[model samples]
Target: MNTDFLVIGASITGINVARELKQRFPDTTVVVIDKESGCARHSSGRNSGLLDAGFSWSPDTLKARFCKQGNQQLSDYCERNGIPLNRCGELVIARDGDELSDLDEIQRRAEGNGVKLEPVTARQAREIEPRARVHEQALFFPSSASVDPAAVMRQMEQDARDAGVRFYYETSFLRKAGDEFVTTLGTVQAGYVVNCAGLYADQIAQQFGFAGNYRLLPLKHNYLESSEVPGAFRTHVTAAADLSGSYPGTQIFLGVDGKARLGPAVKPALWREQYHGAEGFHPFEMSSVVTTGIGQMFQGGGEICRACLQRFTGSTHSRLITAGSRLVEGIRASDYRDWARPEIQPQLVNTETHRMVSDFIVEGDGKSMHLLNTVSPVFTCGLPLASHICDQVAAATGR
Candidate 1:
């Protein structure tokens, strides 16, 4: 197969890049390929679907800028395409005076970043979410929204097809054969290549001598959707901090389909694509919510997760443990039936620093662009990120 631009990985980033290229250079031929059978099976489909309020990072960071603009861009995309969106907003809750201080810092950061954060009193927070354990205060992000990422990617894929972008699924991009890529299905030659390959992006770019020392580490996360706990959540409520500051903070989501979900315990996985069984991927226990923070859920960490819940939030309603560090009330633990769709993200580890790389890493000049760490809420920043990456490719390759 031959095209002007070849995009690897069928995630939202790749899809957005393809479409953007087509829109900019309508005469240019764009071809996209993915290792998966379908577009959204991997991390793109398995996330909490919360568009970051554009408030989580420092104002100077790239994450803060893209996320702030990306949230609104995506909201507009959903509106134009009939994709479902709940602009119900989000709440960052504080458990006590200590956590409330964190909220104050977050508000300062948000104001600096030009992201709107409204402070609410304990009574106001309870009015917003009665079940939420609001202690001293809560910050409301009015621009935040709950989005179905899988739906967004699906729509992008369709729109790309309509615009003449070709998709080759189940296609593995092997080593480069001179100026072309040798794939399992066929040989692909293009003026430029963009690798949005989430998990193996660094490896692909390494072949072209980019992304100097980044290696992917699997961060496994799973959620338990209660069978009996009715979807009672109105707005998205999440914790203020991860405490350890290692992994992500717990955020509870009420799906457009009427299911409330908590968790996504973050831990390292031995293998990227390997799953032990339902117990590992789909644990269905009440106490399993807290199991992720202490250790692996498959081990005896369920009690630890439960213990953390009792210790921090002071509530065991199954709905509130991962929500934050506050003592929430009104919500009770119900019988949880099974695990929701679990996902593992490619957490880029700087081999030299031996730490998780939080920022989006882009390498390559005009010839190729490799997007490493395009995970999670990156979907929120897809449109602009795609535009920026494509512009780089355009400049580098003179396309």
Candidate 2:
């Protein structure tokens, strides 16, 4: 075999997997490939750029366990390598009486998952952010942090390169040629392959006949920038309320650069992994913007519904709407100069059942392995997950 392992994606997942493999087996030859000319062209590069100290996961799952560990690991890495990371923490604000109950439930989940969370009064939340308008209560997690996603991804690429792992940019894995894989440039004979192909992971897994269990449902997450909060403290903020019945809740955030932004409204898309505005603006991208606005309104409850209705009507939704109204006070929706485009994230939708895979899925029979639906905090849990994947492969191969 020309190489011991071939990782088909250069995002955080693929690069961290390669890094772990190299650390475990220094003699093994590992190569990483990405269709883009550089790493993190998709979800990894475009995100809220938060470290996510507080994650929502069942206690028994790998996501819950690894998320906390990964948060610490990622923060340590940033500090060691001089990567820019903001331990800004996160505040889940409760805007109404009902949201207080949701905040309490989140606190219970966090405690069970071994994550630290504290209930704070509106006064305390105001102390954290004088401009924050949490009318009822709030949940504060001091461990949450944010980082420049692009910087962290670039650092991972540099680390992998320094560790002697080969990387090929503008290269794509076309298909499987018997037991070996064929790429656009050449064929690579490898003993085993790892598919961390973020948005298209399921497609790549099908080439190896291991993707029968799941399919990729691409969701477009959009972000609207804010100039209202200038030089704000480095802290990630979110809504404690269940905004339109989504998992992580509906929320707005401030990046490490101190720019507030809202969005990442989940809208289903037909294509597998399509990023809006990467090449040019498309009209279809606006379809989900309205839905996202509606979701935000629902999360805000009755008090904000009128504002949501007004802003979403006519061509106002087509262009940037300044966050001037009482619904999104202290935020100018117009401050969002341009859409940061859309990020194509892979959600595990079971083809047979036609339902979303609520949990992470890993399938293999010892010699080879495939990771499907490694979304969200997967980047945070990459190192530990890589170790687990390696152990699984070792048990299968008796390596």
Candidate 3:
């Protein structure tokens, strides 16, 4: 097979990149290949599905800039394409005096990133989310929205196909030979290759001698469905404070569907896409999770330990609902047990340190660019990131 460009991975990043490339160079042929039989069978389909409101990262990071733009773009796309979305807003709840300080810092950072955040008192938190039971103040980001992740990927795939992008499913990229990618199906020749292979991105890039800079460490994020409360919660609830130790910032979000799910705890796993005790769990990953979790606890301290304990014990539907209520006042723990389930997030682990990348990393010298570690908010930044990638590719090819 021959094409002008080959996009490895048909997730949001790959499809978005392909679509953007075609839009810019209408005459160029673009081909997308994925190991899965269809689109979004992996991370793109199984995520919190929240369109972040741009407060997650520092203003200087690529994530912060692209996320701010992507959030707006995604909202607009959902509106145009009739994708289901809930602008239910988000609350970064500060539970104690210590968390209040972090909440303030988050607010300041949000302001710097051009995201609007309102510091509301506990009373005000209840006013906005009548079910909220905030112990300290909360930072409300009204612009944050949620979407059905599968729907978004489906729409993107449809759009890309409509734009004349070709997709090859159940085909894996085995390696690269000279200027062609050796795949399970056949060798594909291409002028440029873009690797947006999500969980396997680093491995794919390494096959082409491009991703020696880092190694991917996969972490299993577990989610619990609310057993009792089916439709009690409204807005997303996140930890208002920065937890001590290796816990980045313990936060949980309530989905728009009213089921409260917790987690994405940073449990390191050996496999690239391990989920604990779930359908995708790998037995070999148990030791890794234990070791990494202990290391994180040592570094982060009691806060992460508490959070981990909560997650382990709270895996039950009833416990999750209770935890959600305690964290977010008006939420009825019993009302959410019906809709909770486990969800795993893929983390880009540094090969040397075996630690996850906290920020986004984009690599390419112009002709070909690989989007490495576009973990969480990448979906929200799809538009801006696509534009940026397109601009770079165009400049490199001088097209």
Best by lDDT: 3
Candidate 1: where is the Cα deviation over 4 Å? Answer: 228-231, 243-246, 275-327, 330-333
Of 1 and 2, which scores higher on lDDT? Answer: 1
Q: lDDT per residue, candidate 1, 137-213, as tens digits? A: 88888888877878887888898899889989989999887898998888988988999887678778989989877
Tell me the tens digit of each residue's lDDT in model 2 across 261-380: 665455545454545434444355344434433444344234334432332331132232322122134555556556566675677655455445656667776445778887787777
Whole-model lDDT values for every prediction: 0.71, 0.69, 0.73
Provide backbone clash counts, one per model: 7, 8, 30
Ranking by lDDT: 3, 1, 2
Estimate candidate 3's alpha-carbon lDDT, on a 0 to 1 scale.
Answer: 0.73
Worst 10 residues of 2 by lDDT: 318-327
lDDT of 3 by residue, 1-399 (tens): 999999999988889889988887899999999999999888788787888998858777888888878999999999999988888888877777767777777888788889978888888988777666677688899988888889989999999999999999999989888777799999888899988888777767776667684654455565555553645556777775543222334345656465555544444455656554455566665555556555654343354456556545544555555555566654454444343333444555454444446677777765568778767778888778878877777777787
Among all windows of ten consecutive residues in candidate 3, which has the lowest summed lDDT? 242-251
Q: TM-scores, in order shown? A: 0.85, 0.84, 0.85
* Each prediction's RMSD to truth: 6.5, 6.2, 4.0
Better model by lDDT, 2 or 3? 3
lDDT of 2 at 165: 87
